[model samples]
Target: MDLTRFFADVDAQPWADLHHAYGSAADIPGHLRALAGESEEAASEAISELYGSILHQGSVYGATAHAVPYLARLAAAGHRTEDLLVLLGGIAEGGADEGDSDEAACRTAVAGQLPLILARIDAEDPGLRRAAAWAAAMTGAAGQVLPALRMRGKTETDPRVRAELLGAMAHLDPPGTAAEATGAIGAHEPGEVRIVALLACVDGGLPWGAAHHAAMLSLLPANDLVQDRLDLERNEPLQYVVEELLRRDTDADRAAAYTLLDAALRSAVPEARAEAVWAAETACLLSRSAPERLAGAVEALAADPADVSSAYSLLAKLGGRAAAAVPVLARLAGGEGDPADRALEALVAVAPDRAAPLLARDLERRPRALAAACGSLGGGTSGTPFPYDAVLLDAIRARLRGGGPGGNETIRLALLLGAWGSRASAALPELRSALPGAPRAVPKALVAICPPEHRETTAEFLTAAARTGPADGRLPAAAAVRELTGDTGPLLAAVADRLTPGGPAVQEAARLAAELGPEAVGLVPALRSALSGSVGERTSPQLDADAEIAAALWRITGDPEEAVPVLAGVLAEAEPTWMRWTLGRAARAAALIGEAARPLVPALEGLLDGRVQVPPVVLALHAIAPEHLDGPRAAALLLEAAERDDDAATALEALVALGPPALTPDHRRRLTDLAERDLRVRASGLEPGIAPADERLREQAREAARGLT
Candidate 1:
């Protein structure tokens, strides 16, 4: 275990010039040395430090590549072998920071130690063998690791090690793995081995036949037995399989995922059925048929008290698409407690019209349903709110008058009344009564629920709040006043006063200033002062503040002199995936400047390489300099992004912005396929209003395709 020879040149390696996530790598060698020390506690602390710095959050750096050689040597010498190997595996697999050269260096460093790693694949210790196999695959030296994994797969006795080896083999040699996957997935293999082999068939692009489906059914609930030593991070095997199958997004693939889950749902075993219900939720997001085809089976499972929570969750995620399940959800919603609350929540999301009457009956008792009802209003068109039901409106009014609901429930009540607009004018007295106790929650609702006759009084109250309210309450109050009265005079001073604090408050103030247009020219100095802060590489409030200020400046003054440079700077400095929100704002601001922002075209085009940037960049280019875009290239990128659930809505919006001429015959055909496809595009992101977003994307795709016609 002597590391004297390995340490000979470690200190001389010019660590001062390199950097990791936290900056200087000079301390990296100290941690490396501590990792080889005898104190297990010291080694653990040292490894944690290294993970934080070098391979921080699955991102490799220059220092990471340099440290790899030492780590491989440590593992070779049996110093914390299992831990070091996993570290090496992480480094090998991590995506390097944008524009960093460490990705290749890190992988090559790991591959250079393949002999040491491969030697441990046959170790007497199962844990070491598993680690060795994972590190080998991540090396991505397929020519070297693939043959070794294939050889080890023949004799690996430890079931977990065998599973790990099979996964490694699949990673290193998909075609070769596909050729052998069927035999490994046979009845004779252990369940874990079969699971990995089945996944390989899916991963290797093998035609998933009847055998694969049967194999997966038998493997349901196998997730509890999986140790996941390979660090695959797939907690649910069935869900992983379903997601992968639907991820291909082909008509055939979606059908395959649907059929598999549909059959699993029929399993008599509650555990297997539960697993299928979970996987079906993902399927619902990726495939349109999933909700209709699987909802009945899920509803049947929900009859079991034990499974109702999970079933209700799935139905809720389906949103309006799970309309077929509303009757069952309604029956459950008629009951009481957590299950009923959950069911009513699902019912509210699935069919608000049906949920309204049910919610009115149990409004005070069903907090979850009331919250869901309130949240649904924020999803789409603010003006075209959910159709107000007199029953629900009366119940909300009664609850507010009773004064029992407080905190989030009170907020929810206010939001529900606000959504009904002038129709909820009767609740104004209740809202006004509740306003003093809950100042922040009630103002926006008051603005929305206030009628024209009462608006002047509401505006006066809000204007007073803007001038003299709590620091956190001023901007929103002022914005509401402007929205109702169309007066920027009072709001202008509030915007200037709030701009100096510099967070979300600043961002909101800048947006409010922009809404004032030429009337906001008085606040341009404050907006410029807000932009005077330092910029960071990633998205931050300051970055968003800069983007908002720049856009506001141009809108207010119609001068690109101050705004254009800040927009260009934001576009240039913001990192793609990490700073996407800021990048998008910068691009949209550039769109506002139009051809005067022409100098930013290249940066905006570079931003196109990121999925989050594509939508805004496309729209920006079309607005700034559409001729700079290569129509086919933009079409190809937009189409690829459209296939992803998270990006589809925005991507299609960009695709439509490209106009019909950008679409070739093939692009048009794909657009038609997407518009007509059962698989949804907008169902994957973390947004609360997924159903509305998905439908919007669906319609956008159809409109884009129809435009071509």
Candidate 2:
């Protein structure tokens, strides 16, 4: 064989020709094999050419697949093994495919090359040595090569080569590999090597000496080792390992180790006092336990102020479980206990309902504490009625009936009503009466207590207040009413009637009406009319009117067929991005309107294809016509959008929606090739100029390619 000419020819030919040459069965075994037996320089040149060709053509070839085997034959035939070994290493690490060859052939080729590859791992050329270690690892020949590599790695002068050797050893796990791994634990090696060795030992289920265990423990900063140790020590019947770990581990490690201790506590082992405290405090945060078990800890903490903070912290974390501590919390709220105020605040914070009655009863006796409790409960009432609702309502009604709307009592009564939610509906007349000359607190309570059925009345009041009352109070009243009624018919009607052209109040009402759902259905036609009016003619008030009307209509009908065309029109006309996005959402909402929506698929596909006047509406189109669009067209659009990096998320979403059949092998190959190049360029801190959408498209392509294989 003319090695120099062969090398020249291999390099001179384009990648396509080389791929074609290697793909041909007849040219691979005999012709390529002859090149492997040439001089070291020639062999090296040939391997480099093969690597470049494989990468450029983006196809694995049969001849390139046999390169390793040819190298092995050269070694056996008494050629200088160093160059052959280096060439074999390059082939292994080159990411070349064996043209979808069988696994048995791959293993045979790898096995044949292993001895020469291992022998030259100590070659004077550091690059060749590192390449050998990598190739040995890539060929999956770790078992045969790991022991020799480990021994050499212990004293290998080059840090980079030593690291590769250790990494290679990490891949192999034949019988007794764990024993070797255990022996390497205390060896003077890189942290990476030590970590790998520890994992190997853990995987092998090898018992550790105290010294080895301590060395493994010292490597706790490596998360893998810490987790492995936790898994191992958790099953042991003794608590010492876990307890010691809790004391010595960092906060993260302690948190993990505590989880195991919690399991141990759950089992039948006799408990230690310190372990119990740690379990009670730490374990409480990780998971739930029986109320009885937690109560024991709570009572212990409550008995001593020294433990009060921990007790309170645990109670807050327990959330609803601390309901049983209501009585103690109530006592704390009372002025009698040592840290009574703090305890009371903590109790109010934890289980407000359970402490409400006590706080209300204490209000007359300890007005300051009562004030604090009322302030605590005044923020917003829970939707569920508390047990104190009837009592609180009765007290407020009695105060009203007594004809004394005087001072702090009035504020207290108002706070009580606000905290009672809808149950305070019974106090509506008193609330209505208190609206006059009553403190701002009274109307705040009225807003909170107002029923969904009275949403119209509330809207009217809010409108009047917005027109004449304090700005702060008016907005809150409107907000509260909007939240309470959702889309009640009367509320929608009030918003529509008061909706003036271009007013902030009208716009606010429109926003509220939209949030109300099917209850606002009556406003749809009005909204459509407003949207149809000229742009300059549409006031903020008119837009508000239109928005509220549209919201009401959608809420009432829940039928997209009745709404999508209007929304699509709005999407075509809306200038603001937020409004455009909302119109898009409305389109989405229409698609969700049940089987009646099947007829809208064509319209959606049209919008998606930019056949209509609206902005690119792929998401809405995808939502409605996922299974209906032309797959190839949709895929092409996705690829094009991805290439531009425009709305990558939406593009990828559309590609995924297009699904498997649309992702042909050619599409996948292009995407994978693009991604590999992009990743390399990005890693080097050079901009690949690939759009975000293309990145996702590449990922989808890679996944699709993998599924084919």
Which candidate number has the best lDDT?
1
**How many clashes (backbone N, Cα, C below 3 Å) per candidate?**
1, 11
Model 2 RMSD in angstroms: 19.4
Query: Which regions in candidate 1 have their CA more than 4 angstroms from the true location?
Result: 3-53, 95-100, 231-235, 319-343, 351-367, 376-395, 398-410, 433-441, 485-488, 499-506, 519-580, 593-658
User: lDDT for every model?
Assistant: 0.80, 0.51
Q: Please give each candidate's TM-score.
A: 0.85, 0.37
Regions more than 4 Å wrong, model 2: 1-296, 319-342, 349-354, 357-386, 389-463, 466-508, 511-562, 565-588, 591-709
RMSD in order of candidates = 4.1, 19.4
Question: Model 1, 1-709: lDDT tens per residue?
Answer: 5568667779789998999999999998888889888888999999999889998988888888888888888888888899899999998986432343788788877888899899998889999999999998988888888878878877878888988888888877877888777788888988988988888898898777788988988888767647565655665788888888887867777768878887887787888888888887777666666666676565566556556556777877666666656667788888888778888887877788988898899888888787777773343421124569998888888888897877777777888788788899999888876765556667888998899999898888888888987677787788888889887767888898988845558888899899889988889878887774565543467777888899999999998988988987787777776778778888888888998888888888877788767877888898999889998899888898787653576677778778877888899888888878766766644434554567777788888888766
Per-residue lDDT, model 2, residue 692, is: 22
- Range of the 10 consecutive residues with the lowest summed lDDT in candidate 1: 376-385
